[model samples]
Target chain A: MRVLGIDPGLTRCGLGVVDGRPGRAGMVAVGVIRTPSDRDTGERLLYLEDNLTTWVRRFEPDVVAIERVFADVNVASVMTTAHATAIALLVAAKAGVPVAFHTPTEVKAAVTGDGRAGKAQVTQMVTSILKLTEQPRPADAADALALAICHTWRGGTEIRYAAAAARAGGPR
Target chain B: MRVLGIDPGLTRCGLGVVDGRPGRAGMVAVGVIRTPSDRDTGERLLYLEDNLTTWVRRFEPDVVAIERVFADVNVASVMTTAHATAIALLVAAKAGVPVAFHTPTEVKAAVTGDGRAGKAQVTQMVTSILKLTEQPRPADAADALALAICHTWRGGTEIRYAAAAARAGGPR
Candidate 1:
């Protein structure tokens, strides 16, 4: 299965694509979409939508995984982050790709075996897991990759569990 | 000038359109766009976009005015409101209509001359100002009309001030 991960932000939205499922995966692409702060919020949102639509069409992933934004974060940035997230969700839905949201802690736990793992540790593990020659620059990019990896692994388990449940004739 | 005002919400998005300027205005349209709560967020957002796009096209407003969402308000609903607000902003930008945000206080003050005026008072004032025979149904619709009226009156002052500044050979 192919998955596209997004770390949503108005200024620097990170995008990462990965292929495979369960224990093994390969990175297909990683990058960020930047919008100028000087532009009006509407224009910036439009730019984000354009870029995200492009990414969705170009990659044609089976699923889109996004890092969920919490309301408890810095008040000033949370609203903008939420706006960016809405765009990501809209794009994925418009493209007919299912979406999954992973919190920062959930992503860290899935990749580093610790819910409170530091950024460096998460990056290290992502690099090792994907067998990349170098760490993904910009913490947002790494975070996006981690989200994809987390979804891939977790989603595999979910599918298997459902299959097993079907074999048993019903859900518990 | 015509103005389209939106009171953004996921479940009940209020829409109001007004014509004229400042002290004299007429309500051209007032309604709400309802989405099923059982639907997923992405699908709801897409439904909102579609409805909002139709509003912009049919009304051909000079500007789009939206109620600004604050982070401190009911955390559970704030994120969804922000998402709806983003879709409004995006639609305005795509349609090439200037967008303006008016705080709740600003709208209240513009309509009733009291920033902290209660909802009932604002609704009464809107009904009177638009010379309507009865109150606009649903508090959301009333609030939206208030926003458009606020922008019309305030935006008029802003435009006149800018013109005055130009007449004086530059901004002070």
Candidate 2:
């Protein structure tokens, strides 16, 4: 299965695509979207949407995974972040890709065995899991990769639940 | 000149288009982007971006006008609004269109002759100004149109200031 992970933001968004099978997982593509300073909010969103749409079209991931907002802090920032996140989800939905959300804590826990893992630690774990020569820069990209990893593990639990339900003749 | 105005929000956004020429200003389009409640924040933003981009491409506006956030309440809400605004600006810039911003009071003053006009009064003025058969269905769309009209009137101020600057520099 192919999965796309995203770390959404106004100025920079980190995106990563990965492929996984029964016993193997590999990174496909990863990059950051940087918006210009002179541009206004609307322009930045458009830039992100256009770039992200093109990236999704090119990568063709079967599923999309993104980090969920943690708190209700700073209403404006949250809304802006939410807007960025919304665009990511909308793209996947439009492209017929199912979306899964993972909290930062869950992602950190899955990747580093710690719920409160620091950004650097999460980056290191992502590099280690992906077996990359160097860590993904800007922190956002690495977090995105970690989010993908968390989705893989979480998805495994969902599969088990489905199998259990199927054996019990319940909804799958 | 064609101008697009945007009223950014978390779930729904108001979009308004107007043609501006010193004396004549007419509404070209006005509508709201509605998002599903079940969708997450990231998903909503993506949807807005896609729809807005389509609007920009289809309408080919020469300039874009958007409202500025000034209220002190709900800081996070303001931030998200700002992000949405940024997205609009980014899209216009990409299309090689300039952007102008106006505050709530300014737009109200331009449309209703009062800076502190209530939402109902603003809506009435917007409907009258655009010669619409009925009030703009959504309050946000009406406010967005007000911003567009404000931009048309305010745009000349910049030209006048530029002329003054040029004259000041002439053989002085």
> Whose lDDT is greatest here?
1
Cα-based lDDT for every prediction: 0.93, 0.78
Residues B68-168 of candidate 2: C-alpha lDDT, one tens digit per residue: 77537565566566546655665676677888878888999888899999999999988887898999978988888888878877775566677788889
Winning model by DockQ: 1
Each candidate's number of clashing pairs is: 0, 37
Q: Specify the CAPRI tier of model 1.
A: high
Q: Show model 2 residue runs off by greater than 4 Å.
A: A21-25, A36-51, A70-83, B9-12, B21-24, B33-60, B69-95, B128-134, B163-172
Off by over 4 Å in 1: none
- Output the lDDT of residue A135, model 1: 99
Error of 2 at B96 (Å): 3.6
